[model samples]
Target: MVENRRRSEEPLHCLVTGASGYIGGRLVPELLAAGHRVRCMARSPGKLRDHPWAGDVDTVRGDVQDAESVAAALRGIDVAYYLVHSGSGAGFEAADRRAAEIFAAQADACGVQRIVYLGGLTPRGIPESSISPHLRSRAEVGHVFLDGPVPATVLRAAVVIGSGSASFEMLRYLTERLPVMVTPSWVHTRTQPIGVRDVLRYLVGSATMTDEVDRAFDIGGPEVLTYREMMCRYAAVAGLPRRLIVPVPVLTPRLSSHWVGLVTPVPAALARPLTESLRYEVVCSEHDIATYVPDLPGRPLPFDEALSLALRRVREAQVATRWSSASAPGAPSDPLPTDPDWAGGSLYQDERLSPVDASGEALWRVVEGIGGENGWYSFPLAWAVRGWLDRFVGGVGLRRGRRDTERLRVGDSLDFWRVEEIEPGRLLRLRAEMRLPGLAWLEMWVETDPQGGTRYRQRALFHPRGLLGHVYWWLVLPFHALVFGGMTRNITLAAVKGAPARVNEARAVRIRGDRRTRRTSQR
Candidate 1:
């Protein structure tokens, strides 16, 4: 390929699947920064439209399981990054195997030069059957690529220490939420965790490797620490007093996953696989990747440094992509909010319309700034109770706050909801991520009334699935007045109070501009 020249020497056309996912979202910018042309393949390309680098790359709607789509995405691509994985769930292994096989076959048919995969690192001596289904599925996917006609490089990593990563979030929540933790036996298991930066470096470098390298490489940081030691070190790094972690033998992976789900923002479906994989030592067996990628000075950051970096990102809210960036498998497939109510069966709506005293822009500002630190303008205790209930049922709790403080994006996660759609200052629609029997959406709109005043329209819609869905909807119907009604009243009041400041700021800017113009005219 390209007469043995370094891939860096010539810009390679790269196709990144799962562009909306955590790793794939971060990897695309890195590849582009290195002068590689990137084409992203996503099932919903709109999810990526809000990304800063979205305009620089080409995005196509495609699913890995669809052979025709995969083949089309792979065409005219030098290297294809397989970042899409069926996350740990029931029947995930089969789904992973099928997707990998399809992707490998499509890559081969498309004449792709290289295929790079990021997979979990399995224990050194353990058999595939002994490992967790998540890790085994990952290994199987890697093997499928390596065994394919196209040359493939599989980078196996242990726990990735990064802000917005599932592993780091689990550790962060567990350590921060509880000063004393009754943990599972897996806390003593050893793991060599790697930083997200190093993982991306290795991934980008793999694209340029000689065609001869097609096997799997274990990638991790220099230090290896037990889960207990990591938590202790994390507490220390976070400036918290040492944690009390009691390892109990009675807690199985399933129980521990539930416990983690209750305590952390990560749902049980994801936490289960993570806790299961921690049962064995996942230290890197070899550092053979350095021979090709070659680590730079202070390249693979130490455990504490990685922890510090991740913490800093979390504190600053600079995390680029979160684990929630990718929707869970089998997410609700109901009709969108734009669709007519009749299209979706048995649609229930709790609609509230309030006339606001403030400008539409002011109302919009309050709407966009809702959630996160600014608690939902309704009943705080009710929202907290609802969040706790969701966590108890293995749903993404309200702890998964908004990415930015005052900005609303198409795919941003706000509390227990995901931003399904946003029309600038006009409309903000959020889909429920909490565990519910039916699909739910909350739509907030800033509109101008006939009298030329700001009008705030709020609607909570639910499309019932079955009998249980209808029961669930009626069960929560009584609280709608306090929850939805209070929101309408408080939001408008906040906008009214905030509108004067906005007007003053605009006036001040105009005054300064006028003075500057006067001085320019005199000169």
Candidate 2:
């Protein structure tokens, strides 16, 4: 077709197939502030190198049912974004219909110029009966991503409020810790939810609508709520008060996604594919996305100002992630969670005083090359803005950092601490992955007590797992007593205040809420 109408009149080269998704991480910064030329597609492009749209993207790791990484992320791609999904694999609808039948037969032999997809909204004729199986495999992966590419728009959204959405962080943790709820009957099922800035303004207004090929709109947010009136409009935008919801029709969606995986941290295979795709209904009917966003003004902000801007973006914890595929990136979690809010117990000690010209094997080769992707020596952009504000209020920040940067294991993941014990010249321990209402630790030790020389000890321990973990460690004990007493007086004034402070393999990090990152050895 004239090379698909000369590649849809050039100027798009996009290819965002679930580029580390959550609506392709907010549609790659609205398709790069609308200049287009994305190409993200991931199986982990170096864990999306610090995404904020990570340098306006063009990455490409693989797997869209890997046909050579979706034919090299659809070579010369002009447009192809069918967002991958695999809510806990092993035949996730035959892996989302064999990855949309192998990226729609390699985006139809790579002449691709269009295919945008982003399904969810389900109400049309209102006969969604018993619809589960993850919303009928998300409506059969939107009919195999509009069967074969090049001319497919499909928006169809629903609960995408944002801030690391797991249906808006399980309604901001059952409205900030069960203020008083007992929800069921899919909480009253209705839903129209939309937000993430109106699903990136209807996927960048369906990438400049060109006679909406093979279309399928149905967006949302004009309000039609119900998940217990959107969790009392997110407890009146988290100021709380009004949660008295006691429906309880035999709590099930596998026991409310395991009581929403114990008061929220949404994991139960991503909260059972977000509670089995909300039984049904997701408003949005004609008015054709306001006749194509007629200046996308108002009328999409009720339900308590979109749950108070999605709980002020999860209490202003500035997240930039919502990773799923059940936390892939070498997935393997389940050896610790005993749900007393994820069991805790820790201790650490680190003491130092050597720089008569510094060298305990060069400070144990900079604390055994610290974490993965080389980082964590000292204040890395305040530890990546406090691990993107603890992943924007849902926790587990700086994403478990150590996957390998100079071998030193015991259940790795070393950013939000997880080494849990190591000794190269004297102990090192860590365990908190941020989420403490109880146990936590970051121990470090290196001795020489008889006064032969060194003596470093650094500790930040906590074991509060009950009275709301001792009222959240005495309400963050004076900011964890001034960030662990000013980070052990700035690592002993940078070991005599100078030379030996350079190893940011890439800006070291591990800090958030009384900040952190520990592991010290010298001799």
Instruction: Report backbone clashes per prediction.
Output: 0, 23
True lDDT of residue 462, candidate 2: 57
Highest TM-score: give the candidate number: 1
Number of the top candidate by lDDT?
1
Residues 129-222, model 1: lDDT tens digits = 8788888999999999999988899999999886556787688778765778999999999999998889999999999998777899999999
TM-score of 1: 0.67
lDDT of 2 by residue, 1-523 (tens): 5232323344576888765555675577677777777878778687667555577677978887778778887988867778777866567877887887778778878877577778777766745445666666777777776765557777777786645556776776666567667777888888788676767766766765563367677777777878887777666665555667788888877888888888766678878767867756667776476665553557655556655564442233221112111111110111111112321111112223332223344444445555555555455676677688878889878876676555677767787767656778766666677655544656555556564655556665554432355466666666543555555445444444332345343233422322332232221
Query: Native-vs-model 1 lDDT?
Result: 0.82
Tell me the spans in candidate 1 whose CA falls farther than 4 Å from its real position.
314-355, 358-523
